[model samples]
Target: MDIKTAAAMHRLRLISLPEAVSFLLLLVCSVLKRTTDFDAVPVMGMVHGVLFVLYVLFWADAWNRTRWSPGRAAGYFVLSVLPTGGFFAERMLRRESEASVIAARARREGVVNA
Candidate 1:
């Protein structure tokens, strides 16, 4: 992938974990709000909302830059909604990024065709 695409992927990957954590925390806060005096739902809701927006923006950018197929793009979007999906998304993105880097290096060194 090109630098812009790579950067977009990196951004998405970086936000993925935090977003997931925020989502989980939000859920916990929601539960606590009902069961106890603890009520962090509003704060955590805002945090997760912002992160989720960022993730969507970055995801769109990556999709545009990489020209990913519709199915692939949809898969990523679906992952963003699931409770533990961001972790998996992050892992997948990391592997994809590493593979791209390796391929880029090989191509640069004349070990593979562009």
Candidate 2:
């Protein structure tokens, strides 16, 4: 993968955890708002919204750069919506990035042909 493609994946991976956390916190805040005087939903909602947008933007960039299949792109999009799915997405991205790096190195070393 090229640097831009790798960077796009990295951006998505970095945002994934924070987005997931915000989603979970927002759910908690929603519950608190319903049951108690504590109302953090507004703040959490804004945070989650921004993170989710960033995730989507980065996902699109990665998909464009990597030319991923429709199924793979849809899987990533589905993960963004599911609670705690960002963790899995992050793990999968990390593995993919590592594999790309290894492949690049192998190609550079003449051990593999591009």
**TM-score, per-candidate, Cα-based:** 0.94, 0.96
Off by over 4 Å in 1: none
lDDT of each: 0.92, 0.93
**Clashes per model (N, Cα, C within 3 A):** 0, 0
Task: Rate residue 101 of model 1 by lDDT.
Answer: 98
Expressed as tens digits, the lDDT of each residue in 1-114 for candidate 1 is 788889999999999999889989998999999999998998999999999999999999898988889999999999999988899999999998999999989888889554
Compose the digit string of candidate 2's lDDT tens values, residues 2-114.
Answer: 88889999999999999999999999999999999999899999999999999999999999998999999999999999989899999999999999999999888889454
- Candidate 1 TM-score to native: 0.94
Which portions of model 2 show Cα errors greater than 4 Å? none
Model 2: what TM-score?
0.96
RMSD of each: 1.7, 1.7
Give the number of the best model, judged by TM-score: 2
